[model samples]
Target: MAKKNVLIIGAGGVAQVVAHKVAQSAAEFGALHIANRTQSKADAIIQTLRDKGHRMPFASHALDAMDPAAVEALIRQLDAGIVINVGTAFINMTVLEGCIRAGAAYIDTAIHEDPARICETPPWYGNYEWKRRDDVAKAGITAILGAGFDPGVVNAYARLAEDEYFDKIDSIDIVDINAGSHGRWFATNFDPEINFREFTGTVYSWQGGEWRENRMFEVGREWDLPVVGKQKAYLSGHDEVHSLSARYPDADVRFWMGFGDHYINVFTVLQKLGLLSEQPVRTAEGLEVVPLKVVKAVLPDPASLAPDYTGKTCIGDLVKGSLDGKPGEVFIYNVADHKQAFEEVGSQGISYTAGVPPVAAAILVARGTWDVKKMANVEDLPARPFLELLGRMGLPTRVIDATGDHPI
Candidate 1:
């Protein structure tokens, strides 16, 4: 099989991780091209690839992914076989449209988030990405959604339980615990604007075959993970629940994120001060500003946290159901160290966690193991292959069975 040409559209921390992973696994893909709003960032990523001695031909270009026509032109110019949209969540649909128009396979980490709106109602994918499903199918191009760690691998874990471990699936508690300390007073793991916007809206979950929404941090629980141990993670709205519910209608899909009190206090103060609102309000001096954007401008960039980042992050899916027609529960997860991730890929723990899996998906796509002829979510693909590929790519999955912890 010929290697597929791949083009990555973002140069952020997660995009850095993806670039390193892709460069390391260059055998799966042909020529590599990276495009970003800042061409220097893309060039720097390519430089890193060269410094690492990755045996691959690489190119970099300037791109405004917001312009679908521009992205389409770039894809056509590069003759890219696959378009990995690892950029901001806001640019998802536009990039996906470019992929469709250019006749290239498209994939992204999270569901689309309108820069104008923090968090919309439940089944968020239905609003933007899902609307293009028919178009993608008709165009005969594949679009994979939520191929990141939590939504990507965690979603796969749930499906794995359904395939190998469970007979009747019951509940899925997707827990993401980042015990890493970036040595910063306060900073998000990824884009600050996207990070704050995620928690500010109503937390949505699929429970008992219905949609349930709540205030952020309203439902909290302590989780004793493998390395992170006992940490408090609150039920929060996530991209996986929306797609997971569509696949496993009877199962309860919930997402919980670990956060410290210090972070909560800071978030609370910011929210109360109207610094977290997505709506733009004019200042007395006639400056129009979105509260969230203003706050994001002041906060530290998630990528900067890499060098001083310490500790590990444990993210997994706690799946409960029937295996032998009796109750059974298993936690399938991976623990990644910040230092190790930095040493290997020049990225932090969170970026490593969210970034690695999609490269595996890209490899699978190139290998013809995951190229479905339509738009789909992570669960829509075969979960085992993706998980197995991730095991070889620095992030290994372990399962907690009744007996003890073991490899998946």
Candidate 2:
């Protein structure tokens, strides 16, 4: 098969890692192009690739990803066969449309969000991306949603349990613990606006064959994970649960994320004061400003945390089910070190974890392993291939079963 040209549609921290990973595997791909709202940001990524002595064909462009016409034009200009969208979640639908129109395979790390809304309806994919399923099928182009670590790899983990370890699945509990510290007073690991938006609304989980809603930080549990050790995680809504529940309807699906007391307190203050609202409010000077955007503007960019970031992150799926007509459980997970990620890709662990998997998915598309040519969530495809590819590409998978801990 001919190599596919790849285009990355964001210039954020995750995009940096994506660029590096793609360059490292450039021989498997054709030309690489990156486009962002700021061309300089894209250029910086290309410069980093060049600094690392990657001589792949690379170019950068300034783009308004929200505009489908602009996105389609860029894809056509490059004849990009695969588009990796590490861009903000707000641009997902538009970028996906462009890919479909340009006949390019589409991949994104998160579900799409409306800039003016937070935590809209449930089966969130149905509210946006899945609405375009017929269009993607008609176009006959592969579209993979939520291909990041939590949603991406975790989705694959649940599938792995179904495929290899379970007869009848009972539950999938995804735990995300970031034991890393950026040495900052307070900062989000990714986009502050997006991060805050995630918690400002209702938390949704799939339980009892229905969507259950709760406030962020309302439900908590202690997880004795691998590298991160014992940590407290709160029940939270996430991209993987929606799709995973659909695939394993009999299984209860829930996502839990670790948060320090400091973060919770600060988040509570900001949220209570309406500082995290996506809706605009008038200032004393009558300037219309979005409180959340203003707060985001004042916070340190998530990309800047890499240099001082130290520690590790443990994220995975703890699956429970029946095997041989008996109860059983397995924890399928990965432990990523922030400093190691910085040394390798100039990105912190959060970005590194979220960034690497989409590129792996892209490689599968290029190699025809995951080129299903339809709109599918990560779990909709085969699991082992994706996990094994991730293992070779820096994020190795481990599992704890009745037999004990071992590599997958």
Candidate 3:
């Protein structure tokens, strides 16, 4: 049988990495197509591929992913067996519906977010994607949620702990430290609307066997990691914590993100000024616009930062529990260099790390290893094959414990 076609939504930094990686691994897929709200952005990504000397058959389409009919139409037109939804988190449900209606496998990098709401509740997956469990199952399709780094590989790390290290996991502290710098005075590595919204809301975590709430940058601790050295990470709300809590309720699951003092100061100022609000307000000219979106518009596009970005990122899960009835802890992580990533895929390390995993998941689905034909979170799937494939694709897994830091 001919390889299946894959359709990727969104034309952002992360999507660029996905497009390039998928193009590199073209033999595993049929025709590769990428769509975005603006066809120009999608064409830009295709052009980047051409500039890199890739000779695969690639196509670009204009898609408003929020419209399920249009999305389904595009999927059908492309004959795509797999739909990678890397668009804004707000379009997840609509894109998921399209995938189901079109009989295509669905994958996404983050949890769905309402354009109007900041933080809804813990177990974020239970709020949106989990509601479609029956729909995905009845359609006999695979839907992988949170295929990005934190929710993606970090979730797999928890599973790896269960499979290899510990008999009972006590706590899972996911530390995401982007030690890389994009050489900007003030800029987010990803979409500003999503990035600012994440910090403006109440930070929710799973602790003490229940849901706990805290302010952004409230609780923090210094961690001496492998490459990044000593860095302070603040407890933050994230997608994996929600699903992982459901999977391992007995364990206290929390997400900690490292932010430099400058970022915290800038973010605090923006929040205090009410510039990060998602609600629409009338401007002086009597036109309504969402402040967060306006801020996003003013911010540098994340993709544009790749050329000047330097340094490395260390993201991992520090799981503490018992092994053979003895106390133990293991840190499963990956260290990615921005320069190396930009050299490989015209995007920075942050994008490259987040982008590579879904393609790995897609390859597994195409290979019949992860095509479970059911709705699943990253943790719910088997861990070994996905991690191994990711290692080969660029983001290799490393484990540090009483033994030492070694590749998986």
**Model 2 misplaced stretches (Cα beyond 4 Å):** none
Minimum summed lDDT over a 10-residue window in model 1 is located at: 114-123
The most accurate candidate by lDDT is 2
By TM-score, the better pick of 1 and 2 is 2
Greater-lDDT candidate between 1 and 2: 2
Candidate 1's residue-wise lDDT over 1-408, tens digit each? 667899999999999999999999988889999999999999988888888888788999999999999999999999999999899999999999999999999989999988877678778889999999899999998889999997899989988888988989899999999998988888888888888888888899999899998999999999988988999999999889999999888999999999999999999999999998888899999999888888888889888889999999999999999977789899999999999999999899899988998899999888878889798898877888898889999999999999899998
Summarize candidate 2's per-residue lDDT along 1-408 as a digit string, tens digits: 678999999999999999999999998899999999999999999999998999989999999999999999999999999999999999999999999999999999999999977898888888999999999999999999999997899999998999999999999999999999999999999999889888888999999999999999999999898878899999998888888888998889999999999999999999999999888899899899988989999999999999999999999999999989999999999999999999999999999999999999999999999999899999989999999999999999999999999999
Q: TM-score, each model?
A: 0.98, 0.99, 0.98
lDDT of 3 by residue, 1-408 (tens): 879899999999999999998998998999899999999999999999999988878999999999999999999999999999899999999999999999999999999999878789767788899999999999999999998898899999999999998999999999999999899899999999888888888899988988998999899999999989999999999889999999899999999999999999999898888889888999899999888888899999999999999999999999999988999999999999999999989899999999999999999999889999999999999998999999989999999989988988
As for candidate 2, its clashing pairs are none
User: How far is 210's C-alpha from truth in model 2 (Å)?
Assistant: 1.0
lDDT on C-alpha atoms for all candidate structures: 0.91, 0.94, 0.93
